[model samples]
Target: MASQSLAKIIANQQLNSKDYRLLISAPQIAKEAQVGQFLHLQCKEGIDPLLRRPFSIHDYDRQQGEVAILYRVLGKGTKQLLERRPGQEIDVLGPLGNGFDLTNTADKVVLVAGGIGVAPLVPLAKELIELDKEVAFLLGAANELELLCMGELEQLPLQLKVATIDGSLGHQGYVTELLEELLADSYGQVFACGPEAMLAAVQEITLKAGVEAQLSLEKRMGCGTGACLSCVCKVKVQQGSGFEYQRVCSEGPVFRADEVIFDE
Candidate 1:
C-alpha cells in the first residue's frame, strides 16, 4: 500500500558537493517500505517544477518512523530539494514500486552498486545480513570522490570491494571487471542497481555464468502509481518470445536481470 503525506524533514546534510542525505518523519511510509522501494517527492509548493521527483529509499527506521533518502544534485528538482531544511514539511508519496526479492535461501550473495545507485542497496544488504547470509559488496565509481556511502557501508559485516576508473581507488577499471573475477566463485544470487550500461554488463556476465540476478532500474517518472506511463521500460514477456513495455514505477524499480531488454 502507498500513502501521500507532508513528511517532516528531520535531518538534512551534504555528503559532498553533489550528494546529500535527507531524513524524514513518515511513520506509515516507514512501516510499509521495502528494500528498493522509492518515494515521489514534490520539491516545491508551486508549479515552477510541476512534476514531482523520484528518489530511492536509502534507509528507514520502522521503530522511529523515519525514512532516509540519498540523492545527488542533478538538476532543477534536486537543487530545489537540496535547499530544504530540517523541520520543513515536504509532500511525498511513497513505499511505491516493487522491491527486491529476498526470499532466496542462498547462503552466499553479491551486491553490485555503482555511483549513487548504492542508495537503494543499503537496506537490501542489511536485510541479507539479518537473514544470516554471507554477503559481499562490489562498488564502483568514476573516481574516488563519486564512491558515495563508503563510510556507512563499511559499518556492516559484509565483505567490501571498491573500484574506480582513475587508478586512485582499489581497482583501476570498471566494477564489472571485478565482478567478472568474482563470478568465478559459486555465488548463489547476484543483485545490482546502477546505470543501465552497468546493469547490462552485469546481465551479460550473470547470464553467461548461469547465476540468477535481479536488477533495480532507475528511470524518469511522473505519477509513481503507474497512471502516467512515463516510466515504462522494455521487458521480455514472461511466457512469450516477444517484448513489451512495463512500468518501472509500479511493476518494478526491480526486475530479473535476464528479463530486462536494454536499448542498444
Candidate 2:
C-alpha cells in the first residue's frame, strides 16, 4: 500500500440516529480509488481502541479532492469517530482491499446491501451505471431510522429497493426477501455486503439459483496491512482439497460466493 498522510477532516456529521458520515480531504486516494475498496482509519488518541476501524469507501470526489466514509456508531471506537470535528487530521491507510470485478455484466445487475453495509454497494452501483448496465439496488435496514443514504441512493441512475425488518419503510422483511423476488426474473449476477448472516443468506439463495455472486465481508481487522492476520477467514480453493484462511483486510473484504466458507 502507498503509505502517506492523505488529508484532514472536512466534515463529520451524523447521517442517522445510529450512523455518521465523515468527509475527509484525501485527494490522492480518491484519484486512484475504485468500488469495494476500503480504508483503515486511524482513530485519534493513538489507536486506544487498538485497531484501525475499517470502512468502505462510500464515495469520493476526485475533482474536489475528498472521500467519504459512512459508519454506524455501534461501538466505542465508532463513537469516538463520531466525535471528530472538521479540520482535525485523522490518519487513514487505504484504498485497500480488492473491489468488485464488474468484468462481466448482463442486461440486469443487482446490488444488495444491508444496514451500514450499503456503503460499499453505493459506489459499486455508480460504477455499473457508468458501464451502461441496468442496475437494481436492494437495501436492507432494521428500521426506517437506520436506513442510510436513502435519498442519495434513490438519486442514482438505477432502480432502488428498500427493505426494513420492522416495516417502518419500504418493503417489509429482510433484504433477502426483496432479492429473492428480483432474482425470479433475469439478472446477471449479485454483489452484496453486510452482516455475515445476511451475506450467508444471500450466498445460499444466489448459489441455489445458479447465479454468480461476490460477498464483501465486514471483519474486525488489526494491522490493516495484513501483518496481524487478525482478519483472516477460511476460503475454499477451486481445485484444492481443503479450505485455507485468507486476509479479509488485504485479499478482500470481497470474495466470490463459492470461495468463502461462511462462519456458522
Candidate 3:
C-alpha cells in the first residue's frame, strides 16, 4: 500500500551541530505511520548517494499532512541531505515496517533510548499516554550536547530521565541504570531503541527482571525493503534454541527482546 513520492519540505531545523530534523508534507505516510515505523528518505536528487537512508518516524500530524524525521549526520548521504532547504521536495518511501504492538500491554511502560535512537520512542510515548498508560522515558547519550529531542520530550506528560557517559547533564551514567529503578517500581512493559551493546544490556537486565521488553534494532541498509538481505538480524526459533535471520527493514525494526540472539 506504500509508494514512493516527492514530499515537500515544510521545515528543516539543525537541532545541533550534528543532528537535524525535517518536517515534510506526506499525507499518505503521515496517516499510515505508527509509533515505531520509519521512512526511507532519499538523501539527494538522482543517484549520487545511490541509496535512500532510513529514518525512523519521529513525529507526525495526520491532520496537517506532516511527518518528521530526526537524524544524525553520519556520512556522505546525510551530509548531502543537510543541504536541502524548506520548500524543496524530497523523494521518500514510507510508513514502512512493523511497529510496536500495544495489545494488552501493561499500564506502566518504560521507554529506553540510546543517543539518536530516541527518535521513534517519542511517538510511542505519545501513543502510550493517549491510551492512558503511565510512561517513564529513559534517554542516554555521550553527553548532554548529544541529546536530541529533550525539549519536545520534556513537554510530554510522562516522566523523563536522562543519563550521559560524561556526566555533562542529568544522571551521570547509562539510561539502563535508570531503567532498572523504574522497572523495580512495578513498571511492566519496556520498549527500547538503542545501540547493540546497550540493547544487549537491556535484554539481559529485563530478562532477569522477568518483564516483557521489545527492542527496536538498527542495522545498515542498502534497501529499506526486504528485497535485499542487507539488514538481517538473528532471531531465536520459537520452538528451539536455533536462530534464524530476519530482515530489520521489513520483519522489524522492532522485535521481542527474548526472541533475539545477540552476537557475542
lDDT of 1: 0.90
lDDT of 3 by residue, 1-264 (tens): 557899999888998889998899999888888989888888897754365899999999999999999999999888988989999999998888899999999999999999999999999999999999999999999998999888888999999999999999999988899988888899999999988999999998899999999999988887787887989999999896888999999999999999998889
Give the residue spans of candidate 1 off by over 4 A.
46-49
**Candidate 1 structure quality by residue, lDDT tens digits, 1-264:** 568898999988998878899999999999999999999999876544365998999999999999999988988889889889898998998889999988855799999998899999889999999999998899999889889889978999999999999978899998989888987888879999998999999999999999999999988887888888989999998897999999999899999999999999
* TM-score (C-alpha) between model 1 and the true structure: 0.97
Q: Where is model 2 poorest over a 10-residue stretch in terms of lDDT?
A: 43-52
Residue 223 lDDT in candidate 3? 74
> How many steric clashes between backbone atoms does each model show?
0, 0, 0
Estimated TM-score for each candidate: 0.97, 0.96, 0.97
lDDT of 2 by residue, 80-108 (tens): 78888898888888789888887866769
Which residue runs does candidate 3 get wrong by more than 4 Å? none
Candidate 3 TM-score to native: 0.97
Query: Whole-model lDDT, candidate 2?
Result: 0.87
lDDT of each: 0.90, 0.87, 0.91
